[model samples]
Target: MKDKTVAIVGGSSGIGLGVAKQVVAAGGRVFIGGRDAQRLERALAQLGPAADGHSVDSADDASVAAFFAAAPAIDHLFTPGASYALGRFMELDEATARSPMDHKFWGQYRVVRHALPKLDAQGSVVLMAGALGARVGLTGAAYAACNCAIEGLGRALARELAPRRFNTVSPGTIDSELWRERPAALREAAFESFAQGAPLGRVGTVEEVVDAVLFLMGNRFMTGSTLYVDGGYVT
Candidate 1:
């Protein structure tokens, strides 16, 4: 992976940052994009000197296009962040629910569409969805719908990209900042609930999801596959 260029959209935090760190550890040069400059800088700092930072708004086509234009020939591309808004079906507002479709679903779509031309022949694209794509539980309709769409997109792109390799990583209940945003009591309760429900008896870690991404990026033979890092959540 030494000297290989990897471009990651939404790499400022969470799973994206995890993957960026792993890529750098594997001897790859990384360019990470996010809307927050400070967060991006901090991520780059943690990733060491081999990582570069860029400001990108995944919802904006112009921003995505320009970021990709400045990126070097990418050996691998990964998008681990996506917009999320949760609410019951009846409580879900049309605009709010569809917002994730624009950011998470279409955002990933745009990244691949624009980055494809810049990818090396053997390059791979690893997209992040979640267990909601295949499993049904407490998540709202928007999350489930968008994730399912992401999975379908990966399959189609895998066939279209052919030898280039396109795949999706579906994680379940990862302990990311998203969960940290909640109140301590609520967070603890949520974690405990997940621990009891998940077949693995624990939530996933950022490194676990990162390992799956690395596996997909390094393996040339795997494509059009939805690799579940969910720890039996779907079972």
Candidate 2:
């Protein structure tokens, strides 16, 4: 990772931030971007001198465009940004079901379009989708639809992008701040229940997923592949 420049959009926290830390630790420079300036600041603070931050709204073209325009030459791009509408399929509204495409798929499109010209010749791109997309899950129709599309998009880009690699990481329930939205007890119980179904018998970690992201970026031979870092949940 030495001397490599990695850009992580929506990287202020969670798996994205995990990757940033490792990159910097390995003597690479990381530019962390996100919608919240304060969060990016906090993230950069934790990352120390090898890190920088930019405010970016991945869903908006102008914000994404301007954000990338200012980036130093980047060798890898990772965006773990996603929004979901959760409910029964029949009960979901049109906007809720379709929002993932606009925000996740097209959001990635906007970032890639802006970053392509500036990326290193051997650069890599890692996009995130949920484990729900790779398998069936109740009350996640909208989320599943969006990630399923992302899986396809990553494969398509692998071919279109040529020597540059593009991959998707579909993570199962990871132990991250994302669970903070739920009451602590409920979140723990939910994870405990979900973990039992996986062969690993545990939820994943940001460190584990981050390792996969780094692997995808570092391996030039890997392209257009969907790596499930889901603790065997997909199995």
Candidate 3:
């Protein structure tokens, strides 16, 4: 990846930050766009000299256009922003139900629309979804639907985008900030329960899922495909 240029949306923390670290380690130049400028600044500092940070809100048209307009044509694009929304089908308010669509689904819609023209011919794109999209749980209809929509979009885009490969990655039960809100004991118990259920006996790490992203980045032949980086949670 030396000298290669990559752009990552929502790259301030979690899996995005992990990708930034890997990009720096591999001697690649990475530019990450995040909604939070302070967080982005911290992330870029952590990533050292090879990484750059930009503030981009994928939901707003002007912001999206400006981001791609100012961004250099790149070898790869990664859109990893996901909105938080979950509720039972009957109880979900219209606004709550549409939150994921507004951010997670349509946000990528905005990113991909602008990124296409700016992408290098050999460039690839990796869209991050979730395992819940492949299989369902007892709740979170909106979240699951948004994730499913992302995979669908990636498949269609792979064909439409042609040689610029597009793929979706579905990560299951990752150990991330999503669990940080729980009390330590509760969090530990939750993780253990998840581990007991998965055949692999544990949840995934950010490193594991980021490895999948890099694989898609490097593998030119893969497109219109979904890589499930779950710990056997969906299988």
Candidate 4:
């Protein structure tokens, strides 16, 4: 990662922020884009001189385009920015059910489309997928579809974009900032449920997922693949 520039969308918080910190620590520079101005500021402060960023909402094309416009040539790109509702298919309204694809899938599509001009020919792209895509359940039908779609996109793009690697990382429940805002009881219960299903008998950590991201970025031979960091939950 030395001297490489990694552009991470949705990088102000959660796993994206964790990736940025690691990239800096490994002698790489980062161009981080996120929706929250305050969080982006906080991340920049924590990252110090090694990082720079822009305010970007993945749901908006103009915002995403502008964000990438400010970045220099990018050696690697990661899109972990997405927000959507999760529920049983029958219980979800049209908009709510479609939100996952609308935001998570297309948001990444737009980021990658806009990034092509600056993305290095030899660089890699790591798209975010989730264990839900593989492990089916009563609810999360829409969320699972979105993740599966992303994995498909990663595979397709790897062929279309050649030389430039593209892969998806599917992580199970992780103890990360994404869960920090939830009520304590809800968080604990969810973790416990996920842990019981996994062979590891526990949820994963942000560092664990970030390790997968860095591996995808650095592995030249790994393209059009899906790396699962699900603690065997999808096994």
TM-score each candidate: 0.95, 0.95, 0.93, 0.98
lDDT at residue 21 of model 2 (Cα atoms) = 93
lDDT of 4 by residue, 1-235 (tens): 9999999998988899999999999999999988889989999999999999999999999999899889999999999998888889899999999999999999999999999999999999999989999976567898999999999999999999999999999999999888988889989998998998899999999999999999999989999999999889943
Candidates' lDDT values, in order?
0.86, 0.86, 0.85, 0.94
True-vs-predicted CA distance for residue 192, candidate 3, Å: 3.8
Q: Which tens-of-lDDT digit does each residue in 146-218 have in candidate 3?
A: 8999999999999987888999999888887666755789679757866776789998999999899999999
TM-score of 2: 0.95
Which one wins on lDDT? 4
Best by TM-score: 4
For candidate 2, the per-residue lDDT at 128 reads: 91
Q: What's the lDDT for residue 119 in model 1?
A: 96
User: What is the per-residue lDDT of model 2 for residues 92-204, given as tens digits with 9 covering 90 to 100?
Assistant: 78888777778887898888899898888789999898788876577677778888888898999999888888999988889987787768997898688778778889998
Candidate 3 worst ten-residue window by lDDT: 132-141
Model 4 ranges with Cα > 4 A deviation: none
The residue-level lDDT of candidate 4 at 92 comes to: 94
Runs of candidate 3 exceeding 4 Å displacement: 181-190
